[model samples]
Target chain A: MPALVLNNISKRYGDVQALDGINLQIQDGEFCVIVGPSGSGKTTLLNIIAGFTKPDDGEVTVDGKPYNQLSPRDRNIGMVFQDIGLFSHLTVRKNISFGLEIKKSSKKDIDKRVEEIADRLKIRKLLDKKVRLLSGGEAQRVAIGRTLITNPSFFLFDEPLGNLDANLRVEMLTEIKRLHLHLKKTFIYVTHDQEQALSAASRVMIMKDGKALQKGPPREIYNNPIGKFVAEFFGVPSMNLIDGTIIPEEDGSLFQGAGLNVKVKGYSQSKKAEVTLGVRPTDVVVGNQITEDGFGTINSLELLGDKNQIYLTLEQEKSIIAVTSPEVRPELEERVKIKLKENRIFLFDRDQGGRLYP
Target chain B: MSERIKRKGKIPVNIIMLLPTNIIILFLIIIPTILVIWFSLVNFQPTFGINFWQSKFVFLDNYFKILMDDEFVKAVIRTVYISLICLGVEFTIGLLIASILTGNIHGKKILYPLLIIPIMIPPIVIGNNFWLIFSANGPVNQIISIILNTEFKASWFSHPKYAIIPIILSEIWHWYPLTFLILFSGLVNISTSEIRAAKILGATEWQLSWRIKFPKLKGIITIALVIRMMEALKVFDVVHLLTHGGPGTRTQTISFYLFKYGFKYSRISYVSAGAWIILFISLLGFSLALRSVLVERK
Candidate 1:
């Protein structure tokens, strides 16, 4: 059974439709991450799940039980906020055992669980210290420890590591992955940073404009995004989108636009004429030919230690980006040949931007 | 000679900038305090006006007499009692109103300023208005009569047993908004994320206040109470205008009692001694208040 399921969730604030009929099912012990830009209703969905926000219309079923009327105190779900909301008044031990205390557990049980959680989170020496005295990363661990000691059925994290420095974000990312592996509890994490989303999520749900565009494994999402927005949201150098047209032939279709031509075999029977082609930079093959069909000069180059990001303008004044290894360093404004792989290229309709599968 | 001139050129510009302010403080505060102490130390009594040279030196006599006076001791006790009762009531009611104003209710912008209207009225007007309201033929007496189901035309300001209640009510009415404003600012400053975190950790509304919010508001509550304490200890205008320390001296505070001895009866030496005692108490109260503020900062 799924650990949690949201059916037809809808919320509105004045004139803004914050969430529009969102339906999702999160499986048991699955590490699901919602990746979106700001104002995409990701945090609103999480709040609705935690019962901190009431949706206009929805049914939230947790462990196969309807939880629409349950208060956050009774929801049995632990959420860590993006701001690391550790209580400034409580000691580390008291904060960790707060949930158990509210549940009215015995004092001995509370102490044992607090010690166990502290030792697990590596905050053993900080049990008696006030939360106000802790550093940012230490406070983050205390927040996580506070949620973990409760052992809830589902965990919600709303950009919990967004405040940490880059190095510490990566470190905590690994720590969270390891914790998920050890405990096998369902984790639902939300982040606007695409790179962090790709690195951390086991299953990714790409959201835009208060709607979930696609949900799948992270690799599939990076490889095949269904819409133009999701296609652009997930890559380091986002996928280059070019407007083009497809001509159907006897056994194949030829795509031609922006000084490039490609023959695709899968959509010979398709009647689509105009299309938008999206190509990932990694799929563009570069060569030193002077008369190649898809040719452009290097406008600029960014060396990322392992790869070089090449920005080029085509013969039609169109921009395309290509990523190559560090050894293929072309000079400034040097002409280079680019090739597009027929099967790897994605075609979308011109107006609607839905993938055309050609 | 060149070295001396160089040293003189660097004569602390910041200290020179503060010179005028220091001189003003010395003249207005320090010099007057020294004169009050000198006047309290001697019997400067004169049958006629302006005879300071004929005064006799009297060491500790005025202090002892005022300290031993039954009326003075009773006034001190009454001041403390009334001040504590007002502080407790105002703080509680102000905190409640501030919480309601800060809650997600509609029309709060219009209601918030309306709550502070009592604070804008002059103190003397407040005293005189409440004096009329608690009179025998006024609306307050009529309301009390309806509540008790009896003929309650008793003058609330003239009864020895009930005179202090009207002053306490009027003062609370005039000053609760001061505490209300401070606490409302404090309430608005607490982020929503902290409350959400506490709720997800299984906190009810009452528990949220007890654990998360009340601890954060400790400093603001201390500040509000300290201000009210300072104003309450020196309170005299309302009492003088409303009751005039009548009804057998039952409603007299220390400040009101000192006015009779200082100007009416012309026991200037004893009045000065009493003023010095009150000043010492105020200094002690401020010292304790300052220590708490410093510790909270740490």
Candidate 2:
């Protein structure tokens, strides 16, 4: 059964539409992540789900019941805010026990639950210490513990690891994933970090300007993004986008862009418009000129740990990043050949940034 | 050697930048306090002494005489009584009014000015105006007449109990606005995210306010109370201008007592002692209150 569903939810602030016709359904106990850049309405969508906000139109349903009618206290959903938002004056023990105390649980039950969570989160020694004295990672764990003590059915984490140090963020991501697996609860997480979404979510929904641009498993979304925005948004050094025109090919099609000339494939639309080309950095190879298919030039090179990122200038002053092993890094100003894997090329409508054809 | 040069050049620049503020603080605050302490110890009459050291050594005689005086003791108790009553009324009303004002109500802009208008008037004006209202045949008697259909005209100033009540009311009215502003800012500054976190954790609104918001507001509450308490201790302007220590010394504050001795009776030595006593008591009470409120852990 679908654990949660958002049907055509729309929210507007003044003249700006924050969320426009969002429709989503998550299977029971599935971990779902909404990924986007800033101002993409991902947090607004999370707020609507958490009952912190109400959509101007349409409805949300959880377990086949209307969600908007339920008050936040009655929603029985746990939330970890991006700011950590631990009650600043409470001790760790008090913070974790607050939910139980609110439910009017027995003092013994509250103490036992608080102790159990504290020991699991490894904040047992710090239980009596005030929250203001806690380190960032410790405070974040306490915040998570406070939310989890409620035994919520659905969990909402709004960029919970956004404020942590890089190392701590990775550690927290692992812990959250472990918790999700142990509890088997439906989780709806929001983040602007594409890498975080790729690694943590069962499925990723890429949002752009208040609309879902693409939704799929991480591998599929990375390999076959449905729009120019989605294609350019994922992968480190992102997908290389260069401008070019589509010209008529011999048999019944048009060859789009200069980097890779091929007959249009798979697109069923009748319109044969000029479009831009997209290619991943890893899919494009950079080396000395050994073939004609490669766009050859030497522009700049960056050594990122194990692999070197080679920047090449193709025809029409267009630049592309190609990933190569450190041993293959050519001299700074030396000429080099850049090759494209034919099947990895993407084409997009130049006007609307919509995907055209492979 | 280069690092030494950088360090040397920075030190003088820092001191030079701080010179003006240091000079102002020295002259304005430090110098006056030192002079007050020095003046407390001697028989340095303005007509007799060429310098402070030239004065006769009184050797605690002034302190002894002031401590022994009966009226001085009464003044101290009256001052504290007025302050306690004022603090009670002001803090309760201030918290209630602040919470209401922060609510989503209509026409709050107009209400703010209406509430603040009383605080805007000068202290002397407030005292004099209330003096008229509380007079024997003034508003109080008129209200009594309307309520019971029989006129009762009792002199507010002539009755010691009645006089203290008016003083407390006037001070509460004068200063509750400050408390309201401080507490209102404190409430607004509380992160909404924290409240939401509490709610999602199943806390009701009452628990959210009591456990989360109230505890976070302690620092501001402490600061506001201390500022109000210290100012309330020096409750002189209203007492002096309105009652003039009248109705047989019932409403005499320590400041009025000081004025009557130092300037009115030309007993500068005795009033200097009274001034020191007032300062000592205020400092003691303020420090104790501050320690209990501001310095203690939760």
Candidate 3:
């Protein structure tokens, strides 16, 4: 059974359709991360499920119970905000025990539970300190501990790691993933950073303009994105999309545009006349000599330890990026042949931007 | 030698920049305070054919007289009573209004300014207006008469037992808005995420207020209370304008009592002693409050 299901969720804020007919389901004990750009209604959907916001039309079923009419407190969901909303007036211990105190738990039980949680989160030494005195990563652990002590059915994180520095963010991200594993509870995390989403999520949902565009395991979504947006939104440095048209030939087909011609061998039955050929930067082969596909002048190079990101301008001023071994260093303004691995190229319809060929 | 000269020149320039302010302080504050102290030590009655400097030196005599005087003692107690009542009522009502206003309510923009209208009016004008409203044939009596189904022409200003009621009411009406405005700003400044986190943690509305909102607002609450308490302790305008400290000094606050002695009776020495005592008490209270707030912050 799915732990949480959102059926036909829709919400509008004045002229903005914040969420439009969003349908989703998270299986029990699955780590589901909703990844989207800002204003994609990711946070709005979380708010609706947590009962902080009322959806215009939807049913939020949690563990086979209708939760739409319940208050946030009654919904049994815990959320850690991006701001790490720990009560600054309280000590770390107090902040963690707050939910239990609200429930009027026994003092002994609360104390024991708080100590257990503090030990689990490795913040026992900081328990007596004021929340404002804590470092960013420490405060983040305390925020998670606060929710953990409540023993809610689902843990929702709304960009909880957005405020941390890069090093601290990775540390906390690993800690959160470990926490989900140890708890064995369903976790619904939301973030705009695709790297975090890909690294931590067992299943990923990509949203855009208040719609869930794709949902699957991280690798499935990355390898077979349903549309151009998802394909570009997932990878760092993004996927390179070249505008072109497909012409059916005797053997297979030919994609011709932007001062280059490449044979599309496998997709012989593709009927789309106009298409956008998508390629990841790692798949673009660059060499000193001309290839059958195309050639371009190197604009810049960014070193990424073992690899280098090469920016190239194609024949008609169209730019494309390629990642290659650092050993393939070329001087700026040097013309290099570029070849797209035929099997790795993705063809998307020009108008609708939907995938036309895998 | 050049560096030393530059440092010396900078010191003089700083002093020169502060010279005008120091002179103004000397003339406006320091001189008057010294004069008041001097007057308090001497029996300076202008009613007599003697100037202030020529008055008889009676060290501590005016202070003793103030302590022994029943009217002064009663005025101090009345002032305390009025201040406590006003602070209590104003804080409770102001906090309630501020809390309600902080919610997602419509017309809040319009209502907020309207609520502040009473505070914008001069206290003397508010006193006069309230005096008219509590008059024998005014709207208050008219409403009471209708409610009671009789001609309830009870005189609020002259009744010996209840004469201070109208003074307290007018003071609250003229000042509660200040407390409300401060608290409302503080309440709104609390992060919505903190409130939401509390709710998601299963905090009830009351729990959210006392646990999250109230703790965050402690410093602001202290400031509002201190400001209102100080102003309330100096309650004079409404009492003087509405009741004139009587139907027999029934509403005589310390400020009104001092005003009467200094201006009406020309007992400058006695009033000065009383003023010093009140000032010392006020400073003591203010310091205690500030110390507690500072310590809590740490």
Candidate 4:
């Protein structure tokens, strides 16, 4: 049985639909990440799960028990807020023991647990320090410890690393992932950064416009996106989408437009239709030799230490990016042959952005 | 050299701009303080048929007399008692009202302006308003008469014990609004995430206030209480207007007692000495409060 389940949850704030019929379930010990842009309702979904928000229409079940009417205190779900939300005036030890104190636990038990959590999070030295005096990374650990000491059935993190610098964010992200692995409790993390979602999440739910657009294992979602948005949203130097039309040929269907003509190898759609051809930068091969696929002048080059990103401008001023080894450095305005892997191309409906070809 | 001279000339322009305010301070505040200190060192009284400058020099005599005066000592005690009672009542009532207003109460928008109305009213008006309400044949007695099935024409101001009640009430009514506003803003300034985090940590409503809200509001509470404490310590207008230190000095605060001796009885040197003592005590209290706040910050 799923550890937590939300069935058709919906919420509206004034004229805006903050969450639209979001249905999700997480198995025990699953690290499910909800990733979206700002205002995409990812935080709202996290708040709803933590019982900080109420859904307009839905049922939230935890271990087969309805938790809709339960208060946040009664729900037994822990959340680390985006701001970390450590009590500024309290010492780190007080913050970590707050939950147990609320439970009226004995001082000995609370002290033992706080010490254990502090040692685990490597913040034992900061136990006596006020939270406001802590550094960003130290505060993050303290926040996690504060929640971890409670040992809730599940944990909700709302962009917990949003305030950290880049280096600290990565370090804390690794710490959170390790903490999750050790605890083996269900964790629902929310973030707007695709890289964090991809690296930390066992499963990723991509949300847009208050709707969960796609959800799957990170590798599965990255390899086979359900729509153009998901495909383009995931990858850094995202997928290049070209306007094209699929034409019926004697041997197979051909995607012909944007100065490229390529065979749609596995596409079964027989009718000639307007579609968007999606290709990852790595799939586009740029070389000196002229090929049947197409050719374009090298527009710009961005060096990335080991590899380079080459921007190619085809006919009609259409631009597409291709990743190539630094050894294959093409000069500015040099005409280069571009070949896209046949099976790697994705065809999306131009109007609705739905994937039309595998 | 010319540029340097022009820059140097700008310095006197700044001094000229400040000259008017400095002059006014000298005449209004500085001169009066010096005169008061000088007067306190002598046994000067305008009724002695001589200018204050020629009065007999009696160093520390006025101070000694004031220290020995039973009425002055009692007034000081009464003032401290009244100030404390007023502060305690105002703080309790203000926090309760502020907490309620911070919640999702209906008509809070309308109630916010209404809450400020008491603070906007002058203390003198507040004093008279309560005086009328607590008079012998006033609405308070009428309500009591209705409740107890008798005339209930007991005098509020004339009775020594009951006289302080109206004075304290007036002070609280005129000032609790300020406290409420400060505390309400402080409560609002507490981040929603902190409250939500506390709730998720299994804190009940009371625990949320006690553990999370109150601790976070420590600085703001100190600020509000300090400001209110200073004003309460010098409480005079309400006592003067309501009871005039009446029922035989029963409601006499230190400020009222000083006013009665200084202005009505023309005991300038004696009152000046008493004022200096009060000033020293107030400075001591203020410095202690300031030190505590600074230590907390550190």
On lDDT, the leading prediction is: 3
Provide TM-scores for the models.
Answer: 0.91, 0.86, 0.95, 0.95
- Candidate 1's C-alpha runs over 4 A off are A243-275, A289-291, A304-306, A315-319, B1-27, B45-50
Q: Which of the numbered candidates is closest to the native, going by highest DockQ?
A: 3
Question: Is candidate 1 or 4 superior in DockQ?
Answer: 4
Q: lDDT tens string, model 4, A25-73?
A: 8999999999999999999888888887889998899999999899999
Poorest stretch of ten by lDDT in candidate 1 chain B: B1-10
What fraction of the real A-B contacts shows up in model 4?
0.83
Model 2, residue A202: displacement in angstroms? 1.2
Mind giving the per-residue lDDT tens digits that candidate 2 earns over A1-358? 7999999999999988999999998999999999999899999998899888899997999999999988789899999999988888788898999899878999999999988888888889999998999999999999989988989999999999989899999999999999899889999899999888889889889897788778878889998888899999987779998777666544445454545444444434454567777889987777665454545577888898899888878766777888887788588877666666667888888889988776
DockQ of each: 0.63, 0.65, 0.76, 0.74
The residue-by-residue lDDT of candidate 1 on A136-165, one tens digit each, is 889999999999877888899999889999
Candidate 3, TM-score of its B chain: 0.92
Q: State the weakest 10-residue window (summed lDDT) of model 2 chain B.
A: B1-10
Residue pair clashes in candidate 3: none
Cα lDDT tens digits, model 1, B1-298, are 4333235657666677889999999999999788678768888655335256776679888899889999999999999898999999999999999999877899988998899999999998999899888888989889988999998888877899899988889888988999899888988888887788888888889988988889888888888889888888877988998888878899899999999887887777778899999889888987798788779767
Q: lDDT of model 1 at residue B55? A: 67
- Indicate the docking level reached by candidate 3: medium
Local accuracy of candidate 4 as per-residue lDDT tens digits, B135-160: 98899999999999988998998897
In angstroms, give how far residue A104 of model 3 lies from its true place: 2.0
Looking at chain B only, the TM-scores across the models are 0.88, 0.82, 0.92, 0.94
CA-lDDT, candidates in order: 0.86, 0.82, 0.92, 0.90
- Model 3 chain A — which ten-residue stretch has the worst lDDT? A287-296
Q: Is candidate 1 or candidate 2 better by lDDT?
A: 1
Residue-level lDDT tens digits of model 3 in B37-145: 9999999998876677689999999999999999999999999999899999999999999999988899988998899999899988998899999999999999989
